[model samples]
Target: MNRRMAVPEQPLLRVRNVSKIYGRSCGECMEGTGPERESNICPKCGSIVAGGPISFDVYPGEILCIVGESGSGKSTLIKSLYFDDTFSSGEVYLQNYEEGKTNLLALSSQKKRRVRNCLMGMVYQNPQLGLRLDFTSGGNNAEKLLTADWHHVGKIRERAQELLARTEIPIERMDDCPKNFSGGMQQRVQISKALANNPSLLLLDEVTTGLDVSVQARVLDLIRQIQRTLGITMIVVCHDFSVIRMLTNRTLVMKNGRVVEAGLTDQILEDPQHEYSQILINSML
Candidate 1:
């Protein structure tokens, strides 16, 4: 019997009124107020609400960019989505998870990890944070495979070779530690590792931050190639407009831990409505 699977008519990922607070609050800090309330510190209770009640959705096969200056809570949102940091209150739902739509904020640590391994992938701004320099390039990829329960040593190495090749890593250098590669090569290794499991949703956090301009363009091209081939849902955290313009179809502009503007990539570039967004465009021009 041929069985058809049921598909959800919801976004691949969704976040509703998400908030991450850093400091302990008295009972009244978030009282009366809600997700609409921004700015981390509570004047009333002296609690630091570092991020959110932020809201946004990522669709399947769409590249969604999050753009903001430093300390605008963009990083916080990225970390929170992956469960690297705790959120004070919110609901996050991932549609592709086999378990059905679940508020990621409510998942247990073990459950969250399984979800991360199966449904999500992340490449951080710094390779040091994502790739273990001590491990060979292929070994790094093996680590990701192992996380997903691939126990056959030979099969794991074969998968690692395929990922490294896909990301343009030299097969001969697969056994060399990332410490010997240039910055761009190191980032490529990180990308290779991140995609080892073929995750449905990929999160890129400032992946091109410190590379030279030419190298940055090349890295972006590689990312675009991967996105086109995989058609995976992506949430890219970046401040560069060129990155947003080249890689994404939709974008969410964040400031002070809130989504100030959101729309088509061109609309945001040509006709930004929010004041902060205007400033970003103006400076670009």
Candidate 2:
């Protein structure tokens, strides 16, 4: 299933056989013995392989899209990458930091915090996950800046203002609580909060879901503008192919927690070679 797409020699991130199983490990679970791909629950250990033996590369400054329907394990995969959940097995390497030399899963709690705050930013489908609804808009933005060790109060406020404006939130509303915002505005603030540290990687999962269609378009536009303006590497996970077409350079079509197809976004959408990917694209059309 389009197995030979080229990737940069030095990719920004590499996930090798990253796996997450809910129960105990066994030979079948370890080897990812999914006879029916749809069945991630192992008979031997009764462990559910939530995601993986999944592997892929995200190149520098590229938007990588992961698409799959419900129960396809796409959400679990991204959660594992961000350490919102841990993998039962496999290694994740951030380029310039590893070569399978150091395992991210093995990092200390403090070091892991550093990696998440300084190296990556994640925007979840639910704004509450990424934002502090109780805090003022400026306070929410300052929270991330503080996490990255920014101690200058004046500078932090200024940066927060800049980021809020960049996200299209009015500067005057910086003192308002995020809970007061409409769904779309709250999501924008979350985006601003995520971008506060200028992370090298951004993970967006079902970002456009639940918003009004018009609001969705505006958020998408802002996201595209942010990509062009900051050139941040992104991984966007969505069931909607329209979102993928607007955002990604490359894509991985997942089913039952495994990548069934990988290729240029246009190529995969236009002429999907995998049986599952073909069905997904056809349904989208």
For all candidates in order, the CA lDDT equals: 0.83, 0.86
1-285: candidate 2 lDDT, tens digit per residue = 122345567888888888877876776774544525456777677887777788888887789999987877888988778888888888888875655357787898888788888888899999999888999999999999999999999999999999999999999999999999999999999999989999988999999999999999999999999998898989999988888888888899887767888889999999999989999999997
RMSD to native, candidate 2: 3.0
TM of each candidate vs. truth = 0.91, 0.93
Q: Across residues 207-230, which tens digit of lDDT does each residue of candidate 1 receive?
A: 999999988988898898998788
Relative to the true structure, candidate 2 reaches a TM of 0.93
Q: What's model 1's TM-score?
A: 0.91
The stretch of ten residues in a row with the least summed lDDT in candidate 1 is: 1-10
Q: For model 2, what is the alpha-carbon lDDT of residue 259? A: 80
- Model 1 residue runs over 4 Å out of place are 1-8, 26-39
